[model samples]
Target: MPRVEFGMKTESGEEFTINGELTDDELLTITNFVQSAEKLLECRLVQCGNFLPKKITWNQVSGFDICEVNEIDFEALFACLHLSRPFILQKEPWSYNSVSGILGRVFSHHSEVKRELKGLRKIYSDGALSYYFDISIQEKSIFDESRFLSWLNSYQYHRDQDKSVLYDELKSSFSENGAHHIMLIRLHGKLQAIEQLTHLCKVIIKSSAKQS
Candidate 1:
């Protein structure tokens, strides 16, 4: 293997220089970046968290969990997807809601998060979040068991004394906010891979300089 010097200059007049071969410290930085990225990539909210070593079936396919979802949480989840397509989540233009714009689907000034997105269903005609973000419910989801029970508690669904009574309090307190859509999954527990990985790439860039 050969080693050489690397160098570059940004349009902002910032310049960077490095060696073609990774130093011991640089190797550790790259290892951290790669491992962190791999962990984030493996962080999937599945229909089943644990599974047997046998082939699994698709029966568990159900709608989508835990901490109150926030703005950065969405960003972390979105970055993990490495979306090949553009997905600018916004209030439907047809929606007469007083508010408008990207991420407006999640937050609201005039009302609660749920109310801001009330009556949003994913039917063919309905331009719900599903209309724009059409991933499989099994592969990814925006609903959870708590909401399911809430729906069951509603007269519209069912409220069996054995099943619905116990969770009634939880149901009442569980805000119908759509935060559970992506759940509260922080990538590698708040590891910012884009910035760190971009840094590692800089450290690992092959040098064009010839060895002396």
Candidate 2:
């Protein structure tokens, strides 16, 4: 798929650029940006240690992960996404707390990643992150099992008792504050498709206005 480059300028003379492959849902979101009376885009960066998947399909990611070793730069990612939209960057620990959160959501079969988003709303004073992305997707996530299995494999918790007890701990840790590697990206912006794709979606947003 062809990559699209996006550029924008703020009323205050700031300039920003981003290039990536968009998913179908993302394209739809961007299209909505163009039609809606709202011109602002709410964007946020989901950074991780590893390179993000080259091609992300719509609704493909079940949830995001961030272990202790893979801390993302919240400041940088937030700035990039904030430029294009009314953005929010949820801050939490990227440690055992994150692991436990994922596990808690799994054991309860709840997929919203509440554990991952500890202190999210209080920080923003904006009700919740759902104002950006559909929190409902979590209830029906496709990668829940995968995330759970990945956690199990990470610690090599093979013994039955160890696994059982760990599950309980995860549920308990759901309410604690800790670091999380994953972040959410919810954008409301215009979509000018530079190119379409059979495998992946690619588009661009450019500004003819000069920087101040």
Candidate 3:
């Protein structure tokens, strides 16, 4: 059997590598683990170079690496694999006036968003990391400086009004034709950039599925 190599991190932060054939049983185990809410919090993929596509490193001083995924094709594939509605994960609190955690449950089952969640295991386990999607997070999110405060104020205002119906609509535009979501994650007490948020969204989707 042909062998494939991959890496992963556990809840204890220890790392290990696996070298074996990509069998169906392994694939099913990985997918099920990633989609489990309990496991989604800490497990992560590591040493994923073998699963991603090949890239040439620039020898010159001005060289850089490139890995890109087409949004249209990715969304199409995502919809094809999914049978549920997409949601938004708000990092900041919605309103101090209402009961805590209620809004979060109303919006997403989990209030926190993480990059190296279990759902991402598939990217490395199935070779989608290199060919289908990128698994990196922006060091500095643009939302940290721009658009976050404004969005936060709007969210607070809607929530303060005690209009759960209006707040839900403001949270996610549930249009049938809508393709994807632009999520805002507030890390270090602020919203980070919008880039690569798709990865977090994917993790949340998988984790949430486990709940339902």
Candidate 4:
């Protein structure tokens, strides 16, 4: 039988290499396992890499390998797998707000975001990180900077006022780190929310200039 090799990190923060033949049974097992884990963790299965027979045929698979089958919940795992398969197969544009919604749900469910926020809070209690905005631009323009700064300032002001609506406005008007963050989590994929954000910024700048 031809063999394939891949690597994965377990929940315990341990790294292990997986080597085996690619068979329908193995595929189904992996799919089932990933599905269960996703339900327990409320996330999605993202393919990290593929193994072909050519790469592993000659070399002995050797490393600090540890193997164990930790207990798993089968039902929840399959549910998450089912929810995620369609999204994985389709190529669709993800909006900033929609991405944010997905992430909010994940963070609330997983507590990983909460843990990170706690670490950040220990360093900066006043939420100074809120002031930092990442703006991606293809071409530098004074008008673009002005509009972006204005939008950012407006967002900050509303945030300070405890306005719930500002979250949507800011996410829609400016790119969201959370959206990009979640895409990385859910699909193990990179999202061009920054590109979409820059495009929106340019449109806003052009429209503002036309009005003047």
Give lDDT tens digits, candidate 1, residues 1-212: 33435454555787655343434444343344444445443544221222111221122343222233333433444444332011111232211121112113322332432332343222211222333443233332323333333333442224455554323433333333332222222112122323333343433433312452
Q: State, as a TM-score between 0 and 1, how close model 1 is to the true structure.
A: 0.24
For residues 92-208, could you state the per-residue lDDT of candidate 2 as single tens digits? 221212322322433243223232234332222222233443322234221232223333333322334444433333333321111121122112111111011101111232211
**Candidate 1 vs candidate 4: which has greater TM-score?**
1
Deviating ranges (above 4 Å) for candidate 1 = 1-5, 11-26, 42-202, 205-212
Judged by whole-model lDDT over C-alpha atoms, candidate 4 comes out at: 0.31
Question: Candidate 4 residues 1-212, lDDT tens each?
Answer: 22334344557897765333333443333334334333323332222121111111112454111122222333433444345432222232232233233333333533543353344332221212223322332332212222322322344222333333333333443245432221122222111222222232233233334433
Error of 3 at 15 (Å): 18
Weakest 10 consecutive residues, lDDT, candidate 1?
A: 84-93
Highest TM-score, which number?
1
Give one digit per residue, the lDDT tens place, for model 3 in 1-212. Answer: 22334444667887765333323443333333224322222212111112222342333664323223112333332232121111112342221111122222333422222233223322212222233332222342222222223333334323333433322342333221110121111221111111122333333334434433
Please list all clashing residue pairs in model 2, or write none if there are none.
41-85, 41-188, 42-85, 42-188, 92-179, 93-178, 93-179, 93-180, 94-179
lDDT of each: 0.32, 0.29, 0.28, 0.31
lDDT of 3: 0.28
Model 2, residue 133: C-alpha shift (Å): 19
Error of 1 at 5 (Å): 5.7
RMSD of 4: 24.4
